[model samples]
Target: MKADVMPKPQNMFQAYMLLFLISSGQIGVGIFGFQRIVGMHSDHDAWISVIVAGIVSHIVVGLMFWILSKHESADLYGIHQHLFGRWIGNGLSMVMMVYYVMVSVTIVRTYIELIQSWIFPTFPTWVLSMTLLLLAWYGITGGIRLIAGLSTISFFVILFFIGTLYISPIKYASWSHLLPIGETSPWAIMKGTISMGLTISGFESIFYIYPYIKDKSNGAKYAQYSLLFSNIIYLFMMIMGIVYFSKGQLTRSIWASTSMLKIVKFPFLERLEYIASSVWMFVVIPGLMIYIWVLGRGFKRMMGWKQRMMTPIICFVIFIGSLISQDREHIHMLSTFTGRCALFVVFLYPVVLFLFQTLILGIRDQSDKKGAAE
Candidate 1:
């Protein structure tokens, strides 16, 4: 007997959800302590680096949209295959799959470390990692629409959480700490911008997310908006960190944003950082979900595996991998290396891919017109 053939068309998300997805994805575990990363290079002028990184993220987002708009129906995987041959494209896709998995792993591990250091000193990494991964697994299996809705909700939770920044702790901030803004050298500031850019790197999700947008033409506009929004948040946080902590203090702060919350006092709330840190699980989960979902999607397309099946296997691997490093120093090394790798992949690869793809498309268009004329 012949099988029935009417599969439901995949539902696409509205343009505004792009804002939530991109913003939430961008504002992950990185922002919890990004001030120190940038501070290491630019000192108190890290906010300048934050602004520069914002501008740079906008430019990169533009490049990505330009490349993607040229092929609205195709995702990055499809574009890669079209631009390169089948084998080479598949190879690149596998590498990207691994990259996405690594991103999820980094986020999960880093967040667990944050929780362990602050909330539960004796918690096992595998247990927390498994819990977070299981949450991600459930979401990934639910489809992109569910993920987008959760992100939208997470975005509001984060916005409300930002109110905590305005409480008593901020009074301790000395705007004087940010005096002489240009004291750092240009090279140092640029290095700091690189650090900020890594924190802002989740905008690359646009490539995978492009095909799922309902209003494809308006997608870039919302994407640019989301990048700008993420930057503003980063800049605000960086500025606040600089004002609140001296360069010496900031360098010592493992989680600068969380540390800032420690000074907050209210009749009802005793330890604000704990509250903020717990709330941050919402902030970090979207990034993890996006990466995990994309990992499942990538493997499904490449290997004919079901995304539901791939989800558990990926989470298991991530759980096992998270167990390897228990030392704070080792975790730092892993995170640092991942951030640099992400910087190269997120910033440089898109520019290179755009140029090469554009040139190839232009030549093909010219040849097609010439053939038509003949």
Candidate 2:
């Protein structure tokens, strides 16, 4: 099959929008409760783990860009077909498509769980699941430019939420809570970094969206900047969680970031956490749309399916997946599975693929030269 074609100029977005797309994608449901998971591994030094994960994400994204740069206007699907022949390549691409679908399910279900747990105990999981999926379907159908626009809006919504964090949470933080930070063992910090894979995984979406970037040269630069921005936000939140709650409390607080917002009070508006939880849909939907869009797009490329036909099918699958996994134990299981898969898919696979591609190209080049000489 021909390599993936370049998107028309009207469909392309600025390289700068990548900053929003990548940043918003990384800062979804994972941020709300990631502190507890990271804290369980690294204790107060969880901030270090966050930094390490962020650096590794930067490296993985660099590898992805390098791979794409070696090919002309190709996305991940095209790269796969080029690296592995069509049969093996389609198999791997299908695996990635399934993974993206799981990611969408995880994001939507986790958000629904948060809403039901925090705001309305009796709310129907299917209702919220269908609602979010419908919103995602609308955005996905609008196309990449609309998806990018949603991400841009999500970025500022994140900023607004971040600004709210300082208002109340900062006042309660205990500076000495983070004392002797490096006391956590290196092994523990590494474990924490591994646990961080899921939270930081969305940066890999760059692989699929790279072909749609208007300025190819600036893609890597802006993508790196986006990762840096996400890292700063995560590090800040990690430190806040460390200081705002006691060690025991921090480990137990599932939604530590949202929990921190509970103290923000306005005379006219009480229960700010409830408001934050509701408004967070704006942040979550864009990331969800991006994943679903990529999943649909991958199928379209690999099987010659229409994205419009695949979009609803993908969303319906995710919606059913969300409804079936409503309880905490099942949600935790799904999240853990996704996280483990992400460690390989988002981090390890790119480096391995890049090296394998380089070796293959080297052997091919040598064979071409030998044949020419003969």
Give the alpha-carbon lDDT of every model.
0.83, 0.90
Candidate 2 clash pair list: none
Over 195-304, each residue of candidate 2 has an lDDT whose tens digit, in order, gives 99999989888888988998889999999999998899999999999999998998888799888988888899888889888998988998999899899888888888
Per-residue error at 175 for model 1, in Å?
0.9
TM-score of 1: 0.95
Clashes of 1: 0
After superposition, the stretches of candidate 2 with alpha carbons farther than 4 Å from their true spots are none
Model 1 lDDT, residue 266, Cα:
76
TM-score of each: 0.95, 0.98
Instruction: Determine the backbone clash count of candidate 2.
Output: 0
